[model samples]
Target: MLFRQVTHDDLGCASYLVGDDAAGIAAVIDPRFEIDVYLDLARYMGVRIEHILETHNHADHVSGHGRLALATGATIHVHRLAAPEYEHEPFDDGWELALGEVVVRALHTPGHRPEHTAFALVDRARGEQPWAVLSGDSLFVGDIARPDLAVDRVEGARGIFRSLHEQLLTLPDSCEVWPGHLGGSMCGGPGMDMKVSSTIGYERAHNPLLREPDVERFVARSLATLGPQPPNFEAIVSLNRGPLLATGVEATPLTPRQVELKKGEGALVVDVRTDQQFDEAHVPGAVCITSLSAGFGSRLAWIADREGEILLVGRDDDDALNAAKLATAVGIRRMAGFLHGGMTSWREEGRPVATIERLAIGDLPARAAAGELQIVDVRERREWDEGHIPGSVHTPYHDIDAIPAGIDPELPIAVLCASGQRAAVGASLLARHGAKHVLHVVGGGVGTWERAGLPIER
Candidate 1:
């Protein structure tokens, strides 16, 4: 048996390749968007990838199922409940995939999504003692799965309760549980302890959801505890299953002369800078998306209307190059060029600038001391609990889009993070989402308050 786990640090997600050496047959579970990793592994192991499996339709990074199948002439197998926009084999409950001596038994567990499934591996050559169960999003390491998917949040929560109790919880106490994601993930609540993998027995004793049985209480906790979804989440989901769009491959940096010439060609320029830099002086009609946060690509993808000739106007040439590559990675390819000279060069050419007021950390608690600030802590919930400023509400950076529905745009919004990096990301997302009165806490949560010697809250 050949087993390898691929973990993506940015999203804290996991995918696995389980192969049978004698049979030269292998199966992949929950693969990532980049097809190269899986392809390389299969070739090195001298195995033909015959089956593709998804624990569930992923909501974060797009799956490589469609592309891999097209590349390898393999069969795509998802649970019967999953209705992928593309072609796939619907494996019903109790379906078995035999890869030589390695047999993977499919157990349908619908909690995270209606079509969720967990694969229990049986090394028939050895014994019936199962080695591991690919829990997908249906089960995480320390925390139970998040219930809210594309369906009604309340209904999903209830479904999760039944799924957890009737399906997942019934598994043998010894089955090793390999979940789809880990801690720091926006998918689950901040209660998650471990990040990689755990066993059914371990989770039953430590996992909060498995510990709770009251259906109403379980549903309430699941619904109320989840963080907000990332902006343009539905759009990304649609694109994932849609036809392949190439991220411009190994995009080259553009020069200022090229940007100047292309300005007349209707190239949409995105200025990723601080609000102060943006408001004071910037290219007319340029969108401001900072080079911070995971959602940077997602937001830019949204602002691009999912279609446009994107020209990255970075803080410098390096910024332009990164933006170009990132834009391509997320499936946005219309990168025409970048502002070669940056704003400085643009200014030498008599181009304008914009400035917007930003808040430092000390300025935040001072206003809080004066009862005149709305400090938005956009870090993960666990980070917030560790050491956040007093009176700051925990609103994750990814949830910036949904915040307008509940958060008042009138309140002076000061976005914060453990460090200022993600705060810059959050502030840009909020501002682009149409929140006018927003500021990035530059010194981050700790820096500003420490300098001010303000009353610190644990």
Candidate 2:
């Protein structure tokens, strides 16, 4: 038996390749939309991909099952309850798939989604006992999947409790547990360990959800920890369940003159550059969303109107291509093409550029003390609770579409997030929303401020 875990750190997703060497057949679980990674792995392992399995209809990122099945001639398997629009072999609880000496058994573990399933693997060559379980969105390293995403919070939490206790926890404590997502993913609550895999015994012992015995308590805890849902979540779910649009839509290169014209026509100019580079200079009215950032696609989808056209501004063609691919995964298909030579060319052509003032942590105290700067902490609610600048208003970056009711737009606003990246994005959004003077805190966030022995109000 051969096993490989492919992790997309930017999205906090994990896809698995389980191959039965004896049969030269493999199965991929929860693949991303970019199917090339699985294809490459199959070629290197000298195995034919015979099965593409989805634990459930994904809500966060687009699934690659359709693409992979097309590429490899593999049968796509999902739970019968999913009722996916695309062709699939629907399996029920206890259905087993044979792969030479290995057995893949399905356990209906619905909570994150009604049709969510966890695949238990039995290595017959080693023993009849199952070795590991692909817990999917059912479980994570140190946390369980968030139950509020699919149905009503209480109902979903009840389902999760039953699924964990009746199905997953029944597995032997020694069994290795692999989840569909890791830390930094919004699929689950915070406090997930960075490790991609854990033992059933470890999670059973340490996971807060698993430790709670009462269903009522579990439901309460689960509902309480619900964080921000992914942007375009409903659209993503529909896309994952329906026929996925074909990939490989190459971005058209637009000359500076064309880019300028498109901008005039209200095309959203998204500058996919580093926060520092974006802070230095960028096309006026462009949004900053670094292509490499985790949740880049989700963030872009959240901020930009789904119906609006997107015009990418990257360092070059490759960056633009990457940006487009990420955007498409989250169902952003209305790209107007990329700036031909990027910001450098735009500057060389004497295009108008805008710059945001970046302030270090040291500068924040004096300006804020003088009542000149109104700090807006754009981190999540949990991050704000951990510790934040005293007097700073908490407005999550995703909710920056409208300024909070109490915050006066005339105040010189300084936006800060965990790092400078989100702050840059928030600062740009504030500027677009008619804030007169916006400052991007480049080198400092709440973490930096706390580490610098600055006063923090928890």
Query: TM-score: which candidate is best?
Result: 2
> 225, model 2: CA deviation in Å?
2.0
**Positional deviation of residue 389's Cα in model 1 after best superposition, in angstroms:** 7.3
The prediction achieving the highest lDDT against the true structure is 2
Each model's lDDT: 0.71, 0.88
For candidate 2, give the lDDT of residue 197: 96
Residue-level error in angstroms, candidate 1, position 236: 3.1
For every model shown, the clashing-pair count is 13, 0
List per-candidate RMSD values in Å. 5.3, 1.7
**Model 1: residues with Cα > 4 Å off, grouped in runs:** 242-253, 257-304, 313-418, 426-439, 446-458
Summarize candidate 2's per-residue lDDT along 1-458 as a digit string, tens digits.
97999987767899999979878999999998888999999999889999989999998888888788888889999999999988889999999998888899999999999999999999999999889999999899988888877798789889999999999999999999999998988888886778979989989999988999999999988877778888888888988888844564567899999998998999999999888888788988888999877878878988887788899998888888899988877778788899987788899988788888889867888888899988899988978998999989989887887776677888789999977878888998888777878899877688988888889898
Per-residue C-alpha lDDT of model 1 across residues 1-458, encoded as one tens digit per residue = 87788876545678999989788999999877667888899999999988889877666666777678878888888886767767778897789988888888888877667788888888888877677888887778877677766677777778777766776677778878887777766567767655577888888999887788898888877766677564445655666656543233454466666765676687767886654566566765566676544445655654564555877776678877766655644556667777775677787877554444567765676676777767788777756665777767777765555454446777777777876766765766666566667776775576457555765567
Off by over 4 Å in 2: 385-387, 408-410, 450-458
